[model samples]
Target chain A: MENLIDIKGVRHAYDTAAGKLPVLDGLEVSVKEGGFCAVVGPSGCGKSTLTRLIAGLMHPDEGEVWLHGEQVKGPRSTVGMAFQNPVLLEWRTILQNVMLPLEIVPGGLKGKAAVERAESLLALVGLEGFEDKRPSELSGGMRQRASLCRALVHQPDVLILDEPFGALDAFTREDLWQTMHEVKAKEPFTAVLITHDLRESIFLGDQVVVLSGRPARTQYVMEITRDGPPKLDDLYTPEASERLATLRHQIEIAQGRAEEGVSA
Target chain B: MTGTLRKILVPTAAMIIFLILWEALVWVMGWPNYKMASPSDLIPAYERYWELFLIMGWQTLWRTVLGLLLAIIVGTAIGMIMGFSRTMRDALYPLLVGFNAIPKATVVPIVALMFVGAHDFNTVLIAFMISFFPIAVSVSIGLSTLEPEYRDILRSLGASQTTIFWKIALPKTLPEFFGALKVSVTLAFIGTNLMEIVSPHGRGLGALFDSGKTNSDYPLMFAVLIALALLGIVLYYVVVALEKVFAGWAERQPG
Candidate 1:
């Protein structure tokens, strides 16, 4: 498969009042076309910054971030992004919010077709009969679902999710994982999910990349293979346990706190 | 249903109780009508001087409305410019804050000098100067509080700055704008009355107060004061109605 996203020797930093603070250093990642890539990292490890870079919301200070064959210059209309907060406009109804991207991107969807597309996406996310309701009227999970529809309605080339389900409870989070898997199965797109939950990464991701603490770099990349579908039972197996142990050990080492667990 | 009824009923009950207490105090004091008119005296005064009260009340109402309208337009524009540009905010915000600190009463004489005996225009000008700062400041604050991620969402979708302003920024400011308007309209009424008092001609309801003071007609003075209080209440309700119509969406709390 061709590489849909390529980040090579990228370094990024924020200039604060004190001085320039580095967030990413010598970062390299290659995601194949139509691949689901999950990046797992500790808090404040620049995981969200990686999504911002891939979405072209910001420029890397050094090296290149290529989407397809071309270098990313600025915000790309072809990329869809969702943050931890749904960021729905309170003034707009759910359907209108879903159609927001179409109104923004020049010469994109509009009129009757836009409405139909937004409605269909809402239905796909189990949000039928909620077209006219304002965002404040919906539950957090429902709002997130509506936002997911908004992100996907434009049919973007890539979808970047930055801790999209991190705010939800355990049960809602698990349910959304299934919903996301089903949606991807229905309509495939290259995806990058930035998360700290190890089980979530292993469950939803085709390839899980562990990232070190700030200034971040890739620590280990593991491909989650299974004979059949990934079940909750799979997490308890010896193979899955071993994989978890290895990744956890790598993360501890990356965070500079792996003294006692290095031999385990 | 009960909430709506309670909103109306509670204020009405309180006003009635207040009026009874005021009447009791006036009766017990046994002051002359010139010194302190009772509620009984006020009713007859209203009947006798209804024509004068109506004309002066209309004058005050129009001035207050016009002045507040101008303030809304000018203040919102200045605020938008300040909100959109960092340089403008940095340059103007401190100056506006300093300007707002000065007593608006002191400024009315200066404004009166500009119009130079144009009573109506002076009243409007004073009202506008008094009311516009809160609108401008609140609007600036509203625009500043917009989540950075909201801008990012629009930007990532390749939205132009104009599109962001119209669709997101303007709508986001509506609740704050209305909140400022509610405060500004009350200030606007006070400004008109203050200018009316200081103006040589003593225009509007303020003229009524000035004349009543000179003539020692306490009943007429009480009548005009009641009219002014009613005017304030009505104007405040106008803003409340507008808030309900425009900012109803903002009131929805997430379950």
Candidate 2:
């Protein structure tokens, strides 16, 4: 399979009033075309920063980021992202919100055609006939779905979700996990997801990369090799329990090491 | 009192008792008719003044409307530009702050004089000066207050700058628009009145007030004062109603 994205030995640091501080140390990750990769880590493991680097929102201080084998310099229009917050525009109706990306792209496709594409995307997310309601009127789950539609409306090649369902109720979050799977199953796109939930990582990911804490480094990149995605019932099975235990053990060791460093 | 009576009837009876006491005070005090006009006297004034007030109010309304329209156009455009770029904001904000600090009332006479007594222009300038700052500041604040997440989401989607402005920035903060308009509309009326007073020739409530002050006809002065107060109340509520229509989305949002 052709690699859609390749991050080669990337390093990032922040220059603050306190002085220089490294966040990512020689970070390396890759994803093939039509792949859905989840990155899971302990808190402050620089997971979110990795997504920013992948999307080219910020430049890696060292090494290179490649999308489709080209150097990542700035933002690529072919990339879509959803954050923890839905971040919908209060004044716009649901349909108009979805159409936003279509209008924002350069030399944008316009008129009836663009609107129709937007409508189709919204319907795909099960938001049909709700194009006119404002974001504030929608439930958190619905608003997040609308945000997803807005991200996908432009037909981006890459999708990045940074804990997209973090703010939702568990029931709603589970519902969205299935909805996301349905979208991916139908029309596959290269994806990078950063999440804290073990179940979410196992359910949606082809591969999950675990990270070390503070001046974080990749500890392990675990490949979830189930023949097909396991259902919610699988969350408590022996096999699932084994994987979950291993992941928790790695994170706990990383946390213990970081606490010793602070004490030192 | 029953269920409805416990709430509505008590308030209603209280209000009626208050009004009756007021009426009885006037009757017992034998106040001069002109000094303290009764409901009966005021009712006739309402009937006689309604048509003439409408005509005169229309003239003032147009002046105020034109001035406010200009402010919205110029202010929103400048504000959007400034808010979109930090460089523009840094360059222009000091000048705007300086202008904002200038007492607008002091400029009205000069503006009126400079325009060679064009009453409409004077009113427009007054409205522009009084209302422009709030509209510009409000629009800039609204534009800048956008969540970084919303902006980042757009960037990831490869949204064009124009679309971001139109869809996200404009619609997301309509409550601010209505808020700016409410404040500016009041300033619009004030601007028209200022110009009317300075020019001393235009036909508006301000001109009527001027003539009343000049002639020492206290009744006419009282009449003009009453009319102006009613006009202010009407203008205020009109903006409030418009805000309700435009900012329904804002109401749904959590504070």
Candidate 3:
């Protein structure tokens, strides 16, 4: 598979009242076309910064971020994003909210075509009856589903999930992970998921990348081999346990709790 | 009761109780009509000066409404400019605060003198000057405080600042805008009345109130006050209605 997203030696810093706060230092990552890459790291490890860099919302001070072999010079309309808060506009209905990107992204969809596309995506996320409902009327989980539909409405080249499920309860998060797989199977786009949950990373991602503490760099990368679509029961299996254990150890190392030489 | 019925019924009942209390208080005190006119006195006053009240009320209403409309346009423009740029906000905010701090009543004379012989224009000018501040402040706050996540979602789609403003900022700030309008509507009335009272051009409800004061016609003075209050209430409701139409999503169910 061809690399759809490539971040090489990305370094970024924020100028603060105190001084320059370095966030990303020599960070490197790549996700192949149609691949789900989950990035895990310590709190404030600049995982969110990495997503912005990939989405072209911001640029790195040094190194390159290439999407489909082209360097990102500025914000790209081809990127879709969802945050942990869902952040759906209170003024627009769920369907209208989903169609928001379509309106902004030029030559995407229009009129009846846009409505139909948004309705179909809403249906895919099991939000069929909520087409006319406001964002406040929906539950947290439901709002997140609508947010996901909005992100994908324009058929963007890359979809970025920045801790999108962090605020949801465990059960809701797991259900959304399944919904994510179903959506991706139909939509077929490369994705970068920034998450804190190790299980969530493994359950949804084909490959999980771990990052070290502040001024984060790619610490380790683990690829999961699964025979079929992910199932909740598979999480309890021996192979899954082994993968989880290895990833947990990597996270502990990333958080500087354990040494790299220590065996798991 | 349904929400709408209760909304209307509660205020109506309150007004009736208030009027009865005022009538009883005046009757018990045995105050003469010139010293204090009760609600009962207002009816005869209305009958005697119905034509004057109608004409003056119309003048005041139109001036206030016109000034409010101008304020909306100018305030929204200034708010958007400030909202879009930090440099502009920083530069303009202090000046706005200082201008707003000075009493609008004091400025009415200045405005009347500046545009002498233009009574209506002066009245409208004072109304605009008084009301625009709330609107500009509300709109700026609304724009500046927009959620970062929403901006990221739009910017990631390569949306221009103009597109963001039209699609997100305007709609998002509507609740605040309407809030400001409600406050501005009342302020506009004050501005109009101030001009009418200070530099009475022999027009508007304020002028009628002033003439009644001079003649010691207590009932007529109170009548004009009631008319002004009624106008303010009507205009405030108009703003509330517009808010429901534009920013109904912000209205949450009362717990």
In order, the TM-score of chain B in each prediction is 0.93, 0.80, 0.96
Candidate 2 chain A: worst 10 consecutive residues by lDDT? A255-264
Q: Which regions of candidate 2 deviate over 4 angstroms?
A: A15-21, A42-45, A104-133, A253-264, B1-59, B86-118, B198-203, B233-255
List the candidates' TM-scores in order.
0.94, 0.82, 0.96
Residue A213 error, candidate 1, Å = 1.9
Q: For model 2, how does the per-residue alpha-carbon lDDT over B1-255 read when each residue is reduced to its tens digit?
A: 697779778967886786578667767888765555444344555565567567777778778778888998989988898888889999989999998888777888788678876777677778777888888888888898888887777766555677677767887667887888888888878878877776766778777667756876445555666677667777778888788886776775455
- Candidate 2 C-alpha lDDT tens digits along A1-264: 879989888788889899988899977788889888888877887888888887778898998989998998987888888889878777677887777777766755688888888788778778888888887778899999998887787778889899999999999999899889888876578899998898888788888888777777777787887666557776778988888877777677667643322322
Residue runs of model 1 more than 4 Å from their true location after superposition: A259-264, B1-14, B253-255
Question: Candidate 1 falls in which docking quality class?
Answer: high
Please provide, for model 3 over A44-65, each residue's C-alpha lDDT reduced to its tens digit, 9 standing for 90 to 100: 9999999889888888999999
Name the docking class for model 2.
medium
- Per-prediction backbone clash count: 0, 4, 0
Candidate 1 lDDT, A1-264, residue by residue in tens: 789999999999999999999999988888999888999987898988898898888999998999988899998898888888999999999999999999878777889999999998898888999999999889999999998998898998899998899999999988898889778877688999998888888888889998888999888799987778667777788988888888788788778888634664
Interface RMSD of each: 1.0, 1.9, 0.8
Q: Candidate 3 chain A, which ten residues in sequence have the lowest lDDT sum?
A: A224-233
lDDT of 3: 0.93
True contacts kept of 3: 0.98
Better of 1 and 3 by DockQ: 3
lDDT of 1 by residue, B1-255 (tens): 598999999999999998898899888988888787877889998898789888989999999999999999999988987887789999999899998899988998888887787888889988998899989988888887888878888888888888888889998999999999999999999999999988876779999988888888889898888889999999999998999888878886645
